[model samples]
Target: MPVARSTKAQSIKQPRAGKAPSVTENVPPEKEEGCQAKRSPSSPQGGPKKRSAFGDITNAHKNQAVTGKKEGVKAPTRKATRPPPALVVAKNNEINLKKSLRKTPPTDVPVEPEKDSVSEEPVQQVPVVEDIDKEQLGDPYASAEYAKEIFDYMREREEKFLLPDYMEKQPDISRDMRAILVDWMVEVQENFELNHETLYLAVKLVDHYLVEVVSMRDKLQLIGSTAVLIASKFEERCPPCVDDFLYICDDAYKREELIAMETSILRTLNFDINIPIPYRFLRRFAKCARASMETLTLARFLCEMTLQEYDYARERPSKLAASSLLLALTMKNLGGWTPTLEYYSGYCAQDLHPLVKRLNFLLTYQPCDKLKAVRTKYSHRVFFEVAKTTPMDMMKLEEKLKS
Candidate 1:
């Protein structure tokens, strides 16, 4: 029984098959002492492959050789033995994607620099005009932010209200008759203390209405009076009532007639009585030019006189206003139109010369016999008697434009 027990103990202690052989087991005794002093060689592949001290999930370490060192010193580590990713050699001249991802610069390999896909050019910047309204940023009533936008909008609206020589088409009324009607409207505007805008809009309404409707001569006064009433309602804070308009016309138009005429004008114009008048444009351009009250009044007088002339009706309101201001500036000898005026008014001195010539000619030569309302109105001290001021001479204006 003792002999059997000794054999059983020896069997239990013996090395099992397929287990990794000890490093000293295969190494000769002579080198076993120096193995630990230098890098240890892994066991030969003919023997069982070495298992990792730190286990791997992929079991990749099972196929690799590991040194029998206690610490991984000077031997290829588990990281170095990683499959396929260890040293990914590029097959051809092409770079391995993995190697490029590492951002490793090429060693002695000559590579041509990539060409740019598009050619580059320096952009020529446009010269920016100075903003005239920037100085008025502090004044809220001046509406400095939207001032440019507002004038531009009015200029755009001017195209819609442009008229031809409707007088040629009117058999019942002549241009002189239309002038007489507008001259009377100016008087009514003064007597009623209506705004200058009201007078301009009233005249616009009359002209636009006349273009569409052919009325008898008897209805001309009715049309003019009704136009005033419509303009008054649109522009006045306390607009004169229908009875007042009838009273002003000496009751020539009945209350029903005035109301009907108003409806007819509104409908004919599609309720578009919001015509862009020269008065508004004149005021804006005068402000932009920073003209004095006397100079502005002179411009206003010149513009108002043009209202009676049938020839000027076809002109754009903005251009008319700008030309009036330029003529006033010339007459006042305040220097020709400046860059600021040109910027805001959208008119060069050259563009205004022709219109300015005609406007100047009208004031200097137009007779004031029965059509004396505008002349008489401006002759008052309240208007600085600008009507008495001499219009700029034609030859001198030509010289000014030439400059």
Candidate 2:
């Protein structure tokens, strides 16, 4: 029994052959005691001991220091280390900046050299023509502002007084009779020394009244005379008296008859007698052409001639004026339908072609017996004798116009 007990104890004391030894089992008692002392809860250091790999490393360092002290081996004191690469570079840059600030900086700005003073000679200026007295300027209608207003007013009122197809509507009054009436009215207007606007308004009133009320051929003269009277009163500063108009009419109508016709004409026209005339347009277009007095008078002659033609009653005042001026320009050997004229008159050569041809025919070919009033009136030297000046041959004019 004692031998069996000894063998069993030997077997128990021996380690298992196949299994690996544990870390705690392989460590020496002294090393384990040191590890336990470093990790103790009641350590000399202030904080509680940490159970980590870093703590193990710190405990190993402490053990090395203690072992060195016990062995009396002197450990070398650590010297101050060089700073990091970035911090070294920053210190060098700061030293460089301080050294640069201590030195004087060179100025990059440039300086200009002074110039020698020189005396200047006085300049001689010519006297301007505009310094002359304004009263010496004779053109009252030359103001651009007033001219613009006149142009705008005429354009606005032109469409209002346009003559419709009076020939188509009136059965009693023939075109010839209408022509005769206008011709006689022109004489009356000339006799009264009335304004050109007055003459045109009077003719317009006659046509406007005729369009609304059909009148006898005999009463047509009275109608025209009454229209002139109404127009003179409306447009003229010193209009002719009713007796003067009656006297001009050869006393064919009494004072009451004249007054009755005037009332009848105004009432028929709805009292709207502010008519636009070709004469104003002629003046404007003549200025655009830079035409002479003779040229303008010729254009006026042609325009006045159109008043007698019943077919021309449908033409616009601006168009008629442009055509007349173009015809006069062509006849006077001046340039025909230039760009300057087109700019102001708003009519190109192509646009003025047909109207110009018609006017040329009226002046050259139309019989002198019927349209005698305009011809005779313009034949005088007072009119620049534009009526006596012959128009260009129609064939040659057509060729030039086509080209």
Candidate 3:
């Protein structure tokens, strides 16, 4: 058998003097030839040596074999790590579930039949009604024919309710008597819980009916009651019954008499009960002024007070309402009547000065003795007691109005 030698043995030089001899005696000729062939041509004089791939492994194994001890290369061991708490719990749950499923026996319980998914009838959807936005109605400044037509219709209708001769026609019914009647009607209106519109309409009906028909002082209550009943029916959502009105009147007029007077009044007016009243115009003007509730209440008090005066019937309802509101704003030390007021009211400060003075005089010098109902009604806290509020100094107000 031939001796085999490693490449390490083939690369060793001969031993020098006094050094142990190199172990090249058992080196194989083939390994020596292989190592010599692998040497670089530029390094034939042997400068720095290059390493072989299996040099250290072969050397370690050869050393172990010569020392008669096995140097077994240990396989690397991995550190035992614990799984996350959630994963551990999940694995336990899976095991428990498997055990439970295996332990439980399946019973022959009857299952419910599935419901039919399709229905025989179709579902109906409701139709929605969209509201018309008032802002998009039309241009306010544009003089469209329809806008003029609307204004003309409103003005013409308003004119129809005007009682040009209301004062002259009622000779027997003095202005004080008329005021007393209206004051009593205000009480009746409140007692009946009627709308303010109903009261204004009732007063209009009384004035209009007096223009054409002769109403004795004795039948005035009957006429007022009938007018209120008709106005209530027209203005209120649920009008008072005949018995309600009769009861408020303390049974002063019988049912048949009430009905007959209502019919006569309706016929005299030709069923034109849709009269424009100061209340509507007052609200519109107050909104334009952005008056507070107290200011508006004061204006409303002034307007309602005007109802007791027969002279105010001659003035246009819209103009009277505007004047009343302007007086109220001035009396409260709020802003004077500005151009915005003029534009909305169609009256300059000079034009409204007279009407404002008239309203102020009426407010300052109210005959509470005769007009107790309206004054007392407004003096309460509910109406903000604006009736009791002092009017602005007349001189200052006059100067302001003049300016």
The most accurate candidate by TM-score is 1
Which residue runs of candidate 1 sit more than 4 Å off their true CA positions? 1-130, 135-140
**Model 1 TM-score?**
0.67
lDDT of 2: 0.71
**What TM-score should be assigned to candidate 3?**
0.62
Query: Lowest summed-lDDT stretch of 10 residues in model 1?
Result: 112-121
Give residue 13's error in model 3 in angstroms. 90
- lDDT (CA) per prediction: 0.74, 0.71, 0.69
Tell me the lDDT of candidate 3.
0.69
* 2 against 3, candidate with superior lDDT: 2
For candidate 3, lDDT tens digit of each residue in 1-403? Answer: 1234553343232111101111122334664454455333333222122223224323443343333211111212321132122233334434644564455443210010011122111112222222222343576664343543543365567766667766576667877778888998999888878899899999998988998987789899888888999999999999988998788778888889988998999998899788888897787678667799999999999999888888887788888888998888887778776655666566666777788998888877776565688888899999999989987778988887776
Query: For model 1, what is the alpha-carbon lDDT of residue 285?
Result: 83
